[model samples]
Target: MSVFQSINPYSQALIQEYPLMDTGKINAALETAANGYHIWRRMRFAERAGVLLNAAKILRAGKEKYAQLITIEMGKVLPESLGEVEKCAWVCEYYAEHGETFLADEQIIAGYQKSFVTYEPIGAVLAIMPWNFPFWQVFRYAAPTLMAGNVTLLKHAPNVSGCSLAIAEIFKAAGAPEGVFQSIIIDVDAVEKILSTPIVQAVTLTGSERAGTSVAAIAGRHVKKSLLELGGSDALIVLPDADLQKAATVALQSRLLNAGQSCIGSKRFIVVKAVLDDFMQLLLNGISQYRQGDPMETGITTGPLARPDLAANLSAQLTGSIKSGAKLEYGGRFDGCNVMPSLLMNVQPGMAAFDQETFGPLAAVVAANDEQHAIELANLSPYGLGGSVWTKDIDKGISLARQITTGAVFINSLVKSDPRLPFGGVKKSGYGRELGRHGILEFVNAKTIAAEL
Candidate 1:
């Protein structure tokens, strides 16, 4: 059978290799999950919560080991990798405490004497996740779905196969029964075969628009529910009256974090003409502070892109944007995956930087005539994922935020996913929500019952 190798993006070291599972192994896993779901679904909420709580403890105790693995495999800075592990633990704790209540039955006043809507588990859910923030993405989907009594089968990115197996082991050590949570090492054809199986009930994907579309089409063909969290070119709007220094600081942090691999990372900086120059200057000053090196080493503020291809793609986009009239302000050079954080000024609607999602440490600045023009520019992208509006006036911020068509919009702050809030996007950015009450309910069947008293 074929094998998948996990390599360190920074050092170019081979971390581990995984052999692909064949048809027999795949069938066995599906059968086990189908059997395990029956038992898991019947368990009490407190019992399920116990398993998740134990998983949280395991994650916390092994944070350093897991964090190091993330850094080695995905090229995230060591500190950020540690933070991702901590966040994964937090998600587990959040669901363990609130999942039952989030999925609790809702009483309704109907014609019958007693009527209510109950949320029940939908069998096995297939989570197809990306490599960027690998641990966080998996836990965010697993924590709630498992708590809601649904089994999970993860098809993680091939480059992070070691991480995928590590997570599965964590759940196993935390007292999860076999097959309740399994990371299957399989190919794309195998994924299609699994999705076609009757045992796999639903699907959730966090990847590029192309991958999302392909998975969604297969899920649709089988009549299985699908939740997609896809690509984004989110706008970071800076109003004239906003705090320039704070905006610049947050903007740089949001864009450069994970070396700008985040789907919700601010791709377009829409600034009002009045304070554009000040914001640009402060942004440049902030960019100068970042230092890129080995992700495992200390004192490195930024790490390389996850792979060489990602860096090359970002380079092409930067070159095309510059050719399309956008000016390269600073730092456009890259050594393999180790890209220097770059900035592009005079970015307009037609330029690659402004029009496409740049999944690297490249920032694009677009000038807006006024507040209305800023909102218009923000909504111009085909993507409607997360966005941010920077303004001191809460009322104006809220009003302008409402005008921008996206999933989640933050005022005076950067956009991010929180366990307490629902997260997803609109239009080509994909559909359905994750996290909070909505997320817990995504894989559950909301059954309405009516009976006479």
Candidate 2:
């Protein structure tokens, strides 16, 4: 297999093959990024902010083209891909507008002296991002670090190098120093050298739990910061009092968004016994209407699951679940990389799909006798990324949402990302927040200035 062949998920056609990056290039980029940080970190915040805002404009103007690359490279539906572009641009502009205030030093008084806290760029950061939400993943890490005055080097997935390079172009066009944001289009082997380098201050990754574990180990050995955003088998709970139709609709949207590729996606549906049948039937009808075909088609609600392996794994998982007593409903077959929206019922706690991340268009149905059982099922997973509870009673929903052991939980709503909120998880779902003020300080040094009297 070619290291860089572009395979169109729609037609399963080989589009093009680009050269894989070598270690030499990666080392050069690391050096350049480190040096760029020296300059970028010292530049006036207003000046850097101007560049970021300009980058945002460039992103807005080129949104279509960027979205096209995302769909072409990874097979995300065009509209959703375009939405990712817009969100990415918004994050950049958000940081440009608010980063200064967020990073501003605050003065405090010691007993007869003054002490202040100041945030500064740590240095260069290495971002190992995933193919899903390609632009959003990179920018979520990049925008905050850059706004905090750090330089960045991205080691993007090989399949989406084109998108990676496109992002670099945006920074360059925005008048950033040549190395301020560089994409090292290299293979997995090249990462170790970059991480071990003296220049790379920390590392961040948004991918699978295995990937996060690997990165965490490498960063640990190097004594560097590693912000991990890992996998999630989040719960979507529907209380007995919940509007079954609304619960089903939001569940369908939350689970199938991005073809169910997101880390914080709603994977497990925990419904109270009182409305299990209603929620199940509604879920079936709802997912059945999602047309599975070429992402470019306007009628299509779901598309191919990135690559053929994803389809194969999803199929095998669903099959095993069926053999283990779970029943498949809706669309469960895989034709190439497309595993049609699948629902599994009678899923007990021991099944892999019950706790493991299916990572595609497969949703597991777990029956809960009551709200307490719902919380128990949601907390049973090692992955604690995100979850949602549906209830007409807002107070009860909030109470139950607080019981789930996840980074984020929603009541009467599906979980999602927002620029104003901190997003991340505990447990195997990984550590560190991705957006908001807390995210900006992840790669920064919060130094204290104290006076001795």
lDDT of 1 by residue, 1-453 (tens): 499889889877888889999899999999999999998999999999999999999999999999998989999999999999999999999999998889889999988999999999999999999999989999999999999999989999999998999999999999998889999998778877898888799999999999999999999999999999999999999998898899999999999999999999998999999999999999989999999888878899899999999999999999999888999999998998899999999999988898889999999999999999999999999899999999999999998888999999999888889999999999999999999999999999999999995
User: How far off is residue 200 in model 1, in Å?
Assistant: 0.8
**Tens digit per residue, CA lDDT, model 2, 193-263:** 88898889899999988888988888999899999999999999888888889889988898898888988
Per-candidate Cα lDDT values, in order, are 0.93, 0.88
| Candidate 1 clashing pairs, residues 3+ apart or interchain | none
How many residue pairs collide in each prediction? 0, 0
lDDT of 2: 0.88
Candidate with top lDDT is: 1
